[model samples]
Target: MIKLKRNDKIGLVFFLAFIISMSLVWLFEERFDQEQWRSNPGKRYKMAKNIIEQDLLDNKSKEEVIQILGEPVTAEFSDNNILIYQLGTPPSFFDEEPQELIIVLKDSKVIHVSVNQEE
Candidate 1:
């Protein structure tokens, strides 16, 4: 059997590294594709609108909001009168700022649903 020379060993190492990298990339291709890397302001706004107009806010409990919009990334309760739910990625070049959905409740019913889009 022939032993590998110094250059041959270096080349073999580089080849192995490349193969490993390619294999990892191939294995994770589907996950990479599923990630949302670009901003779709319109789609996010539409989802927020649907959440508001579809009477999703009729249920006043936090669990109801989760059922309607999946789990919110952020939630706030102030004085039991105001509720804020924020969703999506934080402000960035690749994604619009998190969208805030404010629900004003009266008598355990939604009195107003406000959709705010960050600039």
Candidate 2:
């Protein structure tokens, strides 16, 4: 039979709490990862681009972009109000670069779309 000392019991409680909190964090993180904003080379982003082109959503209002693409991963820049869609490719897992779909906006309208590959 094993009995925990007072300090040992306190330490064990803290340890258990820590482990449970961490597990909860891990679970929620997995849920958050599945959110649309997490930059992936999946068909969703492709469909987003296609929406911009086919629906002529490009050159439209910011609301239009949001309606099509959902919330951006980052802010629209202050200077040019550049809306950046950061994308990652599974095939480029070894590559440390992230592909960017940069939507340059002026007067709350998309003016240019640049596809940049970060190196």
Best candidate (score: lDDT): 2
Evaluated at residue 117, the lDDT of candidate 2 is: 71
Compared with the true structure, what per-residue lDDT tens digits does model 1 show for residues 28-80?
54221111212442234435655565665774665565454455444456546
Residue 20, candidate 2: Cα error in Å is 57
What CA root-mean-square deviation does each model show from the true structure? 14.1, 14.1
Please give the range of 10 consecutive residues that has the lowest summed lDDT in model 2: 29-38
| Model 2 Cα shift for residue 112 (angstroms) | 1.0
Query: Per-residue lDDT tens digits of candidate 2, residues 37-76?
Result: 4444453333334434554456788878766666666665
Clashes of each: 0, 0
lDDT of prediction 1? 0.58
After superposition, the stretches of candidate 1 with alpha carbons farther than 4 Å from their true spots are 1-44, 59-63, 70-78, 89-96
